[model samples]
Each structure stands twice: as C-alpha cells, then as structure tokens.
Target: MLVRGKADRASRPNLLGDLDIPSGLSASVGISEFTYRKGQEVYSENDPAEYVYQVRKGAVRRYKLLSDGRRQIGAFHLSGDIFGLENALVHRLSAEAVVETSVRLFKRQSLENGAETDANVFHRLLSMTTKNLRHAEDHMLLLGRKSSVEKVAAFLLEMDGRLTSAGLLSLPMGRRDIADYLGLTLETVSRAVNQLQREAVLKFIGKTHREIVILDRLRLSSFDIPG
Candidate 1:
C-alpha cells in the first residue's frame, strides 16, 4: 500500500471527486472498482473503449506498441487521475499498472447517456478530454524537439511535482519506462540522471534509482526546454 503524507491528503484518490456525476444517474451508472497487480494489463491497444477509469491507488502507464514491436510509453497516471477517456471507439494505447493498483471504472455507455440529459456531465466530459489533449501536445513537443538532457530534466521536474512527498521523489516506473516515455535509450536516460547527480542537481535516496531528491530545482529547470 502507498503511504501518503499530510500534505498529500488533498490529492488522495476519491472516486468521483474530480468528476461531476449527475445525481440521478449515480445509482444507475454501474460504477465498479478493481485491483490490478503490478505489470498487469488494464486494457490493450485496439480494445473497445467500453469504460473510463480513474486511479484510486498506485500508478498506471499507457503505451503503444509499434509494428516493429518497440514500445513507446505515452504517459503515467497517478492516484486521483482519470484516464481511458478516449474519443475513439477503440483504445489507441494499452495501459498497465506500474505497481499494485486500484481503479474505479465507469461504463462508457452509461456516462454517455448521462451526458445526453445533463449539461454538467457534458461539460465535465469536455473538460477531461481537453486536459488529455493538452498533455498530449506537451508530450509531442518533448519527444520531437527536446534534447536528451532536456527531456530527462523535464521528466524529473514533472515527477517531482506529481509524486514528491516531504521533498523526496519516488518514481513508480523503472529506467526503461522513463526511456520509452522520453523517446530515448535506457542508457541515455541513466546517463542523464547520473550527470544530474554528479552536478548536485539531484541526489539518489538509498541505493535505488527510483528514489531521488532534488538539490537544485533552479539548475534542473534550466535544462528543460522552454515552451
């Protein structure tokens, strides 16, 4: 189980907390929750997009498999974050648990029906869709234009904001996951992180690569490519 600090209480997972669920439809929507083991598939690419999911605990990684069988990770969804809200009928990427994860699932058909009769539900759907679009746009820029060091820098800064607790950042994914997400080789990602550690920009916690402490946030940010 994940341990959270007092400062993280406001961001803790609460099903429907970020969503505007219409009152009358709440009982009829067929909402259910399930747990997925670490590295287990939540859904595969091209699967019918029959449900929307929100992370209640742990983390999820969404990725696409190319024809050559190479994997490209798109994004990581943390606790309280909603995902699988694709516009297409089929999922464009597959999702898997980075750790043992719990998620709340909503039947997409039920949600669509609710949106048809409720303005609030419709607006909420639009807002969630827009948020996903903005993330995708930023990811595209990071992958296509940023240098290797810049990509790694931006990634560290992102995780620092999302998963840091008491000034220590714990990464749920491995170096390979980070490499795929940044469109770089695993060695390159490791090199970038080691360089940061040597420069005193960040320091590793314990002997694990997954835990880090940022020592110089300003110096780290300086390496990130500007928008």
Candidate 2:
C-alpha cells in the first residue's frame, strides 16, 4: 500500500467514527492515506493485519471464493465505515475497492497501545468486534432462510438507508456484486429488482439509470413480493 499522506479532521469528518476513537488516543496514533482503483485488491486473505482501515471515500467489498468457483460477498463497507479490525494476525477475507477509493489507515499496534492506556479505547475495540460478529450472524441467517425476493428487498432497504444522498440513492456496486452479497443468482437479483420497479416500490433515475429512488416505502416495507 502506498502512503498518500494524511488528512486533517476538518477535511474529513468522522474519520474514525467506527472505533469512536477518543481525541487523546487518536492524537498519539498516526494515520496515513492510501487510494485504490476500482476492482483493485485492498488486501488478500491471509495478508498480515498490520493496520486497521477506514473508508474515506467510495466503498469496499469483502468476499471469499468457494470451492466451485463461486464468490460469496460477506460485507460491503461504505464511506465512514471501518474494517480490517482483526484479532487474528491475518485478514480472514479478501477485500477490493468497489470504485476508485481512498482509505485512512492506522497501525494495529498503535491501537493496541492506546487500548492499554485508555479503558474507553479497550471497550470501544471490544464493542466494534462484537458488532461485526452480530452482523455476520445476521447475514448468515438471511442467506439460509430468506427467499431471493426477500433477500433483494432486504438489501434494497439496507442501501436505501446507507447510500441515499440528496434524494438520490446511488449504488456503487452493480448487480453482480449484489448477487454475490445476497447469495442469489444474477438473474434472480435482476428479476427481483424489476419486480420492485414494477410495483412502484422503487425506480431508477437518469439516462444511465444507475441511481435509485424509493417511491413507496410503505409498500416496500409491507408488500408481499411475488414468488
């Protein structure tokens, strides 16, 4: 990873919100910047976990390859999200930039040092780890029990809250990424999305139709998707 220098807090607010790093603890820990191109590998599985990362811009996808050549996306880390907080010495899953992305990185050892001094830092690290584990458990349940339409709906609801900006819900990742993340076929994801469009629950905007706008959130919340 190349260091692109550091950013001041004024330039990037919530630079370390995920860990809720205290000002004192954070001041002692230096942060550096790194940028990755779209589809660029951030880090591969088993790579040394020297640093913890926070998305400064764009998004990231973490996934694993199955035996039959299928890819299962475990999570999507959007702007202001912190990832790569690992207890193990190596990354458990591989991560890639969903777009041309910039990240702020701080050494894991520095964080460990901070945790040793501050009770708040230690509890914050433990809390973040627990949250990650809970999310993984929820995702596993979604994959094991939900139908394709249900999965797609859940995914849309998630992005509706996370990615909506200026009345436009722009998705950084495409259908294939969504398919892998939702554990559904690409065709199935498309069909479910189309069904939602037809029912007036959502619609794509602009000539490129890359942006989404949720129209009837009530119906979307309560509607029964046709199987």
- RMSD to true structure for each model, in Å: 4.2, 2.7
Residues 1-227 of candidate 2 have per-residue lDDT tens digits of 55473556677845555466678777766887888889999899999999888888989999999999999999999998889999799999999999888888888888888788877778888887898898898787667644776888777777888888887889999999999998899999999889999988889988655599989887776533433
Q: Largest TM-score belongs to which candidate? A: 1
Candidate 2 vs. true structure, TM-score: 0.89
Q: Model 1 Cα displacement at 100 (Å)?
A: 0.9
Residue pairs clashing in model 1 are: none
User: All candidates' TM-scores?
Assistant: 0.91, 0.89
Kindly give the stretch of ten consecutive residues in candidate 2 with the minimal lDDT sum: 218-227
List residue ranges in candidate 2 displaced over 4 A. 1-9, 14-28, 223-227
Task: Tell me the deviation in Å of residue 129 in model 2.
Answer: 1.2
Stretches off by above 4 angstroms in model 1 are 1-13
The C-alpha local distance difference test score for the whole of candidate 1 amounts to: 0.86
